[model samples]
Target: MFPNLELVKMVADIENPTLFSHDLKSADILFLDLIVSGGNINTLADFIADIPILIITSAISRWQYPEFIKNREHFALQKPISLQMFQSCIEKAIQP
Candidate 1:
């Protein structure tokens, strides 16, 4: 658990367009926990267009995910990742 990291937002529903867009835009990193299929990519891409996304999963690598999402612009962080590693990832991701 990253006690030092401050979570700007965390949303469960992707359908609430107004709130979802607002929350995502305000966050530095997006922690998405879903297996994105072909049909789901377009809408999601729209909302997460400019944000850095971290796909949290128990899988070993991005290869385990669908080809569409794996090849897209995003990072995969295996579950049970350490606090130090998670913090390191956040730091690297937010850098300009």
Candidate 2:
């Protein structure tokens, strides 16, 4: 478990990204859900500073989106992710 993990905030719907925009800028890691990310991950990523890692959770294929290309340090996780897969992604994201 991430004992030192401090969750910034959770948005059920990112209709108004400005509400959480500030938090994203200062966040160490970003857990992005394509469904709830207002379908503008690119814009969101651009708005934020250089985030170390981005964990993308989506049902869409990675090839379909340009997030992977835009953010080299990102992990694409399918919708129904297992605990192990999630852990691996986190570990990979944090790796130097």
Best candidate, lDDT-wise? 2
TM values, all candidates:
0.61, 0.78
Best by TM-score: 2
Please give the CA lDDT of all the candidate structures. 0.62, 0.72
Residue range 4-95, candidate 2, lDDT tens digits: 56898887766567887888888888877766545555556555546766777888787776644454757778989998988888778776
Q: Measured by C-alpha RMSD in angstroms, how accurate is candidate 1?
A: 4.0
RMSD to the true structure for each prediction, in A, is 4.0, 2.4
Instruction: Summing lDDT over every window of 10 consecutive residues in candidate 2, give the lowest-scoring window.
Output: 36-45
Q: What is candidate 1's local distance difference test score? A: 0.62
TM match of model 2 to true structure = 0.78
Decoy 1 TM-score against native: 0.61
